[model samples]
Each structure stands twice: as C-alpha cells, then as structure tokens.
Target: MSALDRSAATPARVWLIWVALVVALAVPIAAAAASPLLAWRGPVYIAAGFAGIAALALQLVQPLLAGGHLPGLSAYRGRRLHRWVGALLVLAVVIHVAGLWITSPPDVVDALLFRSPTPFSNWGVIAMAAVFAVALLALLRRRLRIGPRLWRIVHMTLALVIVLGSIVHAVLIEGTMETMSKVALCALVFVATAKVVADLKGRAKRSASP
Candidate 1:
C-alpha cells in the first residue's frame, strides 16, 4: 500500500476511536443520571457518587493514553495528557470522598480508618490511597532518585491495586449506576489495564536482554 493510502485511513480510525471511547464513558453516566435513586439523595451525596463514576470512567482512558493506543496523540502529547488525566483522577477521588464526608462525616471517617462495615468501603478506601500513592510517586519520582526498574515496579504494583480495588468497590455497591453499564465499564477498565501492563512487561523484558 502507498503511504497516501495508509495515511488516508488514519484520521478515520482516530475519529472512530474517539467517538467509541466517548460513548463508552458516557453510557454509565447516562444510566446513573436516569436512576430513581438520585431523587431522594441530597446534592452533595449525588455529586459524590457521580464523582466516583467519573473516576471509574477515567480508569479506561488513562491506560489507553499511557499505552499510546490513541492514534492521533503524539507520544509527548499522550504522556502529557496521561499526566493531566491522572491529576483529574486524583481530583475526582477527592471530590468523591469530600462530598461523602460532607454528607456523613462519621461514615467517611470510618471508611478512611478501615472501620466501615461495608466491604465496598474498604475497597474504595484502598483504591483512594493507591490513587494518592500514584500521584505522590509521579510528583517525587525524579527527586526520589528511584531506579527505573524499581519505579516501574512500584507504579505497576500500585496501578494493579487501584484497578482491582476500584473494580471490587464498584461491583459491591448497589447504587445509581445501572447494572449493565457498570459491569461493562469495569470490564473495559480491566482489559485496558491488562493490555498496557502486559505491553510494559514485554518491553521491560526486552530491555533487560542483550
């Protein structure tokens, strides 16, 4: 195939990917927005719950950007976006927790302390901590003078914890998110993370060889 032929298809592919991702991200939010549960909840509580959903949606996007799977984004731009999205993910968690705290300080305290009765609360808190850890690592990665292997290991370890914890946390809750959409989002996050992690592992292995 000529370069022109291959180049002609790239824009179309990029557009399709962007549209599919946007729809995937929007589905759960639409489902949650339609839920009857929100009718009785206060604004803060509703905002907090939706923030969690937003964060979950972010999980799928992060890995795609991190892996450079987004066709139109240059590597430099992709890395930059990954950083910004990572920051947003952290912000979303803060909003989720803060709004919940506003709604019920005691419950938030219990969850933070790992004393919450619900299994999902434990997972949520674990994921929240992992989110903060990843953010901190990113912030201090250069200052800490960590070795490349160690940094990747720590980052990947925390990434796995965040993904798995968030999955469990979302799955265990019965909330505004519709069942089908919630499950589908979780599945997409899992696949995207797995693909990126596997690719990273292979690259690491190849780099280690002569």
Candidate 2:
C-alpha cells in the first residue's frame, strides 16, 4: 500500500478499535441501567451494584491494555494504564464488598470467611483474594526481586483466576445485569485474556529456544 493509503487507513483502524471497545464495555452497563431490580434497591446498594458491573466491564479492558491490543497505545503506555485500571478495579471490588457489608454485615462476613451458603460467594471471595495478591505483587515487584517474564506469568495466571471467578460469580447471581450482555462481556474477557496469555507464553518459549 502507498503512504497515502496507509495514512488514510490508520485513523480508521484506530477508530474501529475504540468503537468496538466502547460498545463491549458500555452494553452491559446499559442493560443494567434498564434493569427493573434497581427500583427496589437503595442508593448504596445501587452504587455498589454498578461498581461491580464497572469492574466486570473493566476486566475486558485490562487484558487488551496489557497485551497492547488496543489501537494507538504502545506496549509500555498500555501496561502503565493497565496498572492504573487494576487499582481502579480493586477500588470497585472494595466498594462492592463494603456496600454489601453495610447492608448485611453477616452475609459479607460469611462470604469473606468462606462460610456463605451461596456458591457464588465463595468464588467472589477467591477472585477478590487473587486480585489483592496480584496488586501486592505489582507494588512489591522490585522488592521481591522477580524477573519481568516471571512476573508476567504470575500476573497472567492470577488474572485468569480473577476473570473466570468473576464470570461464575456474576453468572450465578440473579441480579441487575441483563443476562445476554453479561454473558457476552464475560466471553470477550475470556477470549481477550486467553489470546494475550497464549501470545506471552509463545514469546517466552521462543526466547528460551536457540
């Protein structure tokens, strides 16, 4: 292709990437916004619920950012943004649990302690723990003396935990999120992360070879 053709295509490709991401993230939240259940909930509960939806949607972005799959973002910048998004994700999870605690401390305690009757509760707690572990490792990366490739592997593994656990937790809950959109979001997250992890693993293997 000529320089003119390439230049013309670049902006369009960037827009396409961004437009798709926006649709993927926004549809679930939009579905939740229309949910009839929100009318029965209080302000705190609604906020907390949306925070969770936000967190779930943010999961899709994390792998894309980390893999530098999003257009117009370099690998370094994307990974930097990935760290910030990870922090925001933690904050969302905190709000989710804190709000639930405010409404029902015993339930939240049971969930955290792995004593909850609901199966989703256990998965949620497990996912939350993995998230915290990943964040702590990222913060202490230098202090822990972990190499970059090893760090990526650990991060990817924990990230898979977070994504899968969150999927199960959300799917099992009969709450605000619209069913189809929620499932679609989860599938996209699964695919995106799987792609990134596969690529990273392939690169690692090639690096180790002659």
Candidate 3:
C-alpha cells in the first residue's frame, strides 16, 4: 500500500490525530482567558465559543455520516463510542451557551425567548432549540421506536438547521469572533454541514440506482 494509505489505515495514527486536536484546542482557550478589557476579550471568547460549537457540530454529524466507525475498532464498540462522544458534544454546547449567558445574562435571556432586538439573537435561539430537540430525541430514542433510517434522516435535518442558525448567529455577532481561528472554526461548521448533506444525497443516489 502507498505511504498515505498506510498511515490512514493505522488506528494509532487516528488516535494521535485526535490527541493533537485536543491539545490544539486548549491553546486558544488559554489565550482567550488571558484578556480583560472588552476589546481584548471578544476574540478570545469567540475562539473558545467556536470550539464548543464545532464539537457539537461534529457529534451531530457523526451518527449520520459514520455511525458504524466505533464497531470497526472492536466488536459492538462503535455504539458505545458514539454514545459517549455524543453526550460529550452536548455537554460542550451547554457549557458554550452558558459561558455566553454568564458574560451577558440580559442579552442571553432576551435571545432565548426571542425578544432580543439583535438579528443574531433570534438565530442563536433557534439553533439552541434545535440542539435541545436533538438531545430530547436521543433521550427518548428507544421509547420512540425511531427506526435507524428515519432517525438518521431526522437527526441530520435538525443538525443542518442548527448549523445554519449557528452560522447566522456567528456571522452577525460583532464581538469575540474577529480572529482567524474563530472565522475558520465557523467555516468548518458550514463545511461539515454541507458534507453531511452531500453524504446523505450520495446514499440516496446509490439506493435509487438500478
């Protein structure tokens, strides 16, 4: 096999890549927490915010795009990995939003109930609600008897909605997101969402082919 293929095939390399990403994520968090003044604060917080949102976006996209990945590592292991990672993603999003609320409670409250005058606030609320709904569905998945195919479809659709709302919110926010890191992270969310849709379309096409 080619060198690139060999490297990609190595689970150890995949684990290393994940570890590297975790470390890379910590760097910006440290930087953001260092500032005090409003001008200095926005970029830092924005970078951190992007990390949390990205985590949620990745988690939301995983089941639909690569739900069976964990099993390939070990028998029946994929489902457990999926559950753990998905829960972690949800927790990250909660912490992200909570941080925003802590920084500006009044604004958050206004945003949450749709009374906020800002354009981004409405979109943020919608995205937050979509994430909450996805969590609810996951919690009630067994009781709902949502078949795998149907569940995947609904989950992806909601994920798309969340990403769209989040992008609008981020784009409209004037603070905490000026740095290149924050911009790239938001872009990744959009790209990830587009990829999910593309994957779903590809599956549909294959299924329809004679």
Candidate 4:
C-alpha cells in the first residue's frame, strides 16, 4: 500500500482497537450490575463493588493512554487524559474502601492492619496502598525533583504492583463481580499493562540507539 493508504488505514485500525477495549472493559461492569449477586447487597456494599469495578475499568484505560495507543489522540492529550483518569481512579478506590468501612468497619480495619483472614483483602490493601503512593509521587514529581528516568521506573514498577494485586484481589473474591466478566476484565487489564510496558521499553531502547 501507498504511504497515504497506510496512513488512512491506521486511524481506522486504532478505532477498532479502541472499540474492542471499550467493549471488553464495559461488559464486565454491566454484567456485574445485572447479576443476581448484586440483588442481595445493601446500597453501601453495592456502591463499593461498583466503585471497585470502575477502578478496574479505569486501570485498563490508564495503560492505553500512557502508551499513546488511543485512536486520534496525541501523546500530550493522552497524558492529560491519563492524569485525569488517574485522579478518578483514586476517587473510586477511596469510595470503594470507605463504603466497605461504613458497612463493615472491622473488616476494613483488619484489611488495613494486614490481619484480614481473606487473602483477597490483603491483595486489595496492597493495591490500594500502591495506588495512593503512585498518585502522591505523580503529584509531587516536580516538587520532588525526580528525574524522568527515575520517575518512569518508579511509576511503572508501582503500576505493575497495582495491576497484579488488583487482579488477584478481584479474582480471589467471591463478590458481586460476575465470574466470567471479572476474569475477562482482569485478563484485559493485564494485556493492556503488558502492552504499555513493552511500548515504553521499546521507546527507551530506540532512544538509546545511535
């Protein structure tokens, strides 16, 4: 194909990928909401579960934006959206935890204190801490005078922790999230994260080349 032809095709392909990602991320939340599992839960617990779901869906978006993989969005725009989405992700997490605390204070305390009997609670707590740390570091990046390389390294490392921990937390819990949709969302989260990490490594390699 000609250069122009390839260029024309690129946007279409990107949009297709974006659509797939949206569908992958949305279906699980929709299914979870419609599931019989949520019917018995109180509003507080339901809110907490949905907040967690929203956070997980946002996780998938973060990597795609960071990697500049979204269709028609410039890297600058992508990063801008990433920052906004990151803030929302933080909010969702807070809501998730706070709602749970309101409903069951002792469970929240046990999770926070690392005394929770459930393995999923441990993973959730770890992921929540990592998420908070990442947000704080990003907010203080300028004030802290962190160099670009160091910032990227630290950010990506924490990202991996958040991704893995959240996935494990979601998987281990027999909660409101429907099983198959939950699995699919978690899988896509991993894929998106891996793709971004790979893209960052490739860019670093290319920049280091002569």
Instruction: Return the top candidate by lDDT.
Output: 1
Report per-prediction Cα RMSD to one decimal.
2.7, 2.9, 5.2, 2.7
Better TM-score candidate (2, 4)? 2
If ranked by TM-score, best first, what sequence of candidates would result?
1, 2, 4, 3
Q: Each model's C-alpha lDDT? A: 0.93, 0.90, 0.63, 0.90
Q: What is candidate 4's local distance difference test score?
A: 0.90
Candidate 3 on 44-72: residue-level lDDT in tens? 35544665545534543354324332212
Q: Give TM-scores for every candidate, taking all chains together and pairing residue i with residue i.
A: 0.95, 0.94, 0.69, 0.93
lDDT of 4 by residue, 154-178 (tens): 9999999999999999999988788
- Across 88-147, the per-residue lDDT of candidate 2 in tens digits comes to 999999999999889789999999999999999998898999999999999999998999
Off by over 4 Å in 2: 1-9
Residues 1-210 of candidate 1 have per-residue lDDT tens digits of: 223534665777879989999999999999999999999999999999999999999999999988888777777888899999999999999999999999999999999999999999999999999999999999999999988899989998899899999999999999999999999999999999999999999999999999
Poorly placed runs, candidate 3 (over 4 Å): 1-20, 23-31, 34-79, 96-104, 208-210
Candidate scoring better on TM-score of 1 and 3: 1
